[model samples]
Each structure stands twice: as C-alpha cells, then as structure tokens.
Target: MKKILLNLVHPDINQSVVNKRLLDGIKDLENITINNLYQKYPDFKIDAKVEQKLLEENDIILFQFPMYWFSSPALLKEWFDVVLEAGFAYGGSYKLADKSFAVAVSCGGSKEAFSETGKEKKIVEEFLYPFEITANYVKMNYRKPYITYDAEAGLSEETLNLYVKEYVKYIKEL
Candidate 1:
C-alpha cells in the first residue's frame, strides 16, 4: 500500500464547513498521514527538517487547501519555500522525484463562475498551473487535481456529505 501524506493547509479549519468535513471524513484512514499545517505552525515558524522528513517518508504528497486568490494559502506557499530546498526536493538527489504529487482544492465559487462565460473569465485549471510547474520541477509525477466547487455557496447537507465521500475516494485512489 502506498503511504500518502496529506498536508492539510486550511488557515482556520475549525470554522470551515467544507474542508473540516473533508478532513474528518478521511482522518481515520490507514496508511495516510494527515498533517494539519495551521495547527502545527500557528506562529508560521515552519520546521523545514520535519517537513522534509515527512516528504521523504511518504509515497504521495497531497496538498489539501482552499484556493485563496487563485493560489494556495500563505502557509502552503511558505512550505513550498522552506521545505522544497536544495539537496532535498530539487537541484541534487531530488528526493521528491518519481513520487506522486497532487492537490485537493476547494473553490469558493461555482464551476461556471470560473469559466469565460462567468465572473472570473478563466478556468480553475488556470489557477492551479503553479502546482503542476512545481511538481514538474521536482520531477514528481503530477496527478490530476480533485476540486470541490461552490464551497462558499453553502452546499446542502446531502451535497456536503457526497463531496466528503468523493474526497476520501480521491485520496484512496491516489
């Protein structure tokens, strides 16, 4: 079985209806390490060694976060800066090479809202290109991202539960 490291990067997961539920749905799964970044580094002081160790240990690195300003949250970006350093993730042995990298991002707007016909005038994939670039640079296999749309639009209980299951399934398949 592949050991998956799920890096949960919500700034305030407790108050998040979508992300919190998704986290709860898969927290008990075996062979998966759920590292809550915000909870671990509330002061924004990241331990690069510890983070790199986690990357070294897992077969898959999955980033789960809400799309903020068409990009990842601040801590996730900080993680990219500190953890993916030389001699570890790139420019040397490339520790992350051949490992699978993927993202599970929740969007605040509807799917249509991200299209040219809608408000944003661009697709969701356009916003997620940076992740692909990073994965390519590290030589990791970039998998298709799993996205939850209309997250801030207040999904119904049934819809939320469905998405939670889908998120779990996506992780398992990864």
Candidate 2:
C-alpha cells in the first residue's frame, strides 16, 4: 500500500463535526500519517524542512480540511509557500514529482449551492482548479477531490456514519 500523508488543515478541528468524524474514522489505519496543521503550528510558524521531509517520505499527500470561502484554510496556503519553495518541490528537483495529490474537503453548503443554478452560481470543481494546477506544476498525479457537502449545516447520524466509512475506504484505496 502507498503511504499516505494526511494533512488535516482545519483551523479549529476540535469544534468541527464532519471533519472531526472523518478524522476519527481513519486515524488508526495503517500506513497513514495524520498531521494536524493547526495543532502542530498554532503560532503559524511552520518548519519547512520538517514538512519537506514528510513530503519526501509519503507517496500520497492528501489534504483534509473544511472549505473556507471556496478555498483551503490559511495555513495550507502558507504551507505551500514555505515548504514548496525553489530547488525542492519545483524550480529543478521536483521532489514531489509523480506523487499522488488529492483533497478531501468538507463544504458548508449543499451540492446544489455550489452549482451554476444555485446560490453560489459556480461549480465547486471550478473553485478547486488551483489545486489541480498546482499538482500538475509539481508533476504529481492529481486525483479527483472527495467532497462532503452540507458539512457545516450538519447531517443525520446515519449519514455521517456512512460518510466516515466511505472516507476510510477512500484513503485505504489510495
């Protein structure tokens, strides 16, 4: 199995419902390293060398977070800026080349709300284009994103349970 680096980038995961449940379901699985960014870097001071080392060790990099205003949380952006600097992830070496990069995002709105006819008037995939392009630029295989809609609004117990199972299965497959 490919080793997975699960980067959980929620700003306040302790208070999260959907993201918390998803993490709980997959936390104990083998070959999966869970790195909670907010917990690790509370002051937002990320260790680029350590993060680059983790990237080198893992075959698959999966970013798990709740959607914040159609994009990832602030730290994740900062992580990219600091860790994926010149001579490492790009510019020449391309350390992350050929690795698999994917996202598992929890959205506050419903699926319809992210569509053309919906309130947002744009598809969720459109908003996720930057990730795909980033993966391509770094020469990583960009997989289709996994999304859980209506995450903030909430889901029934049974539905949440099902999503947890599905999330675990997805990670295991990767």
Model 1: residues with Cα > 4 Å off, grouped in runs = none
lDDT of candidate 1? 0.94
> Could you give candidate 1's per-residue lDDT for residues 8-88 as a string of tens digits?
999999899899999999999999999999999999899999999999999999999999999999999999999999888
Error of 2 at 45 (Å): 0.9
List TM-scores for all candidates, in order. 0.97, 0.97
- Candidate 2 residue pairs that clash: none
Q: What lDDT would candidate 2 get against the real structure?
A: 0.93
After TM-score superposition, the amount by which residue 49's alpha carbon in candidate 2 deviates from its true location, in angstroms, is 0.4
lDDT of each: 0.94, 0.93
Local accuracy of candidate 2 as per-residue lDDT tens digits, 1-174: 889999999999889999999999999999999999999999999999999999999999999999898999999999999999989989989999999999999999999999999999998888999999999999999998888999867699998999899998888777
